[model samples]
Target: GGRTPRIFKIMIKRVVVINMEEINRFLNGRGSISSNILTGIMVLNILIHNKPSKEHIKVGRVFYTNQGSRSLSGGVEAWQGYFQSIRPTPRKLMINVDLHATAFYESDSLVQLVVKILNKRSVDDLRRIHDRDRTKLEKCLKNLKIFVTHRGE
Candidate 1:
């Protein structure tokens, strides 16, 4: 008898944020404080992956994909390229904002938290739980100080 291939389901969650302040800072040649923070989150994800192998974990891909017209276009293009490279057959995308992080700390803080979560898990294991119940997740995340806007399903 032939053995069945052990198929693995990976769910990759990604968050993208666009902050005006960060864009202004970058354009003015000033240190992009917000951008730096966002970068930190991306780095954190990589760090999370370092410990566990990719086969056993799920990851959330988060970043700021829109800032302004030009910036947003660039970000979207880059992300589209990246998504295609990954080749997610039925990609599920969600948008969320950390009320506290973005409102108080900075947009980057929220981005960082997302990256941290993504890095620890494998794409297959990363399930999009938000789709099941947007309002419920919204309420849960809101209470936890994270606010999200669902853009795409």
Candidate 2:
């Protein structure tokens, strides 16, 4: 057994057929639409609009990058991002875009991040970090994605 085929089975229990005219009328508030159809359309819109990008990190509807980073207290950096969504209106779909601000850890070593967060002069200051501060540091560093740079030795 070298490799196993990864396949999933999903079954749609019911199908409702509605004409474009009916959908248009419903969208215009002339008629009622099913919740399932509305949910499917919303999910489809999200998938089409949120395809992954190499340069941007997407979390839910917000997209951000390392560019234009502003340093904040405790080694946290504020990044400017944007939230985008497509909504169906009376006769057309409207794209809504809004500015968003998010906080990220500054690019630095673990020791440096700890030092900044604890307001310490150097690693030596961490030798006697209080339990409360240690818990704070744990929460801050938890689930943080770190990249290692290797230099030829």
Candidate 3:
């Protein structure tokens, strides 16, 4: 009755690699910290693949949109091109909105909509969102953290 197939997980170390002083200097001398983090990650990604390393073929990025239900629908066809440009399965990619900043004429519907999305799929992590857009999202994360702690995970 105990016929569970073994699942293998190979862990590779991920690091920023740059010294804190260099990072701080680069970031402080340039633009925002968030922008710097993105740039550094991109550089690491480039470094990770130098030759014909066929291990990882595609990169999965979760794009964030601050706009909720009020975005202009024009030229949305261009998004299809962006989706087609990515090698990974489109299902693996996700876009998350700032739930706190999302405004609707009906507040109840907004909350319900957010909860529905969370139930339908894994909610994207909120650590990278702007500080102003974090209250409701942070509250959700804190509550989930508590629940997970209680569940002994």
Best by TM-score: 2
**What TM-score does candidate 1 reach?**
0.19
Clashing pairs in 3: none
Local accuracy by lDDT, each model: 0.36, 0.78, 0.35
Give the least accurate 10-residue stretch of model 1, judged by summed lDDT: 79-88
Better of 1 and 3 by TM-score: 3
lDDT of 3 by residue, 1-153 (tens): 899999999999975464434444544464334554455545644554443144322224222232333432211111110111111122232222221222212223333434442432323532244554456445544533121133345
Q: Of the pair 1 and 2, which is ahead by TM-score?
A: 2
Kindly report which residue stretches of model 1 are placed more than 4 angstroms away from their true locations once superposed: 1-3, 18-24, 30-32, 35-37, 40-153
How many clashing pairs does model 1 include? 17
Higher-TM-score candidate of 2 and 3: 2
Position 41, candidate 1: lDDT: 45
Candidate order by TM-score, decreasing, is 2, 3, 1
Q: Which residue segments of model 3 deviate by more than 4 Å?
A: 7-16, 30-97, 100-153
Between the candidate structures 2 and 3, which one is better when assessed by lDDT?
A: 2
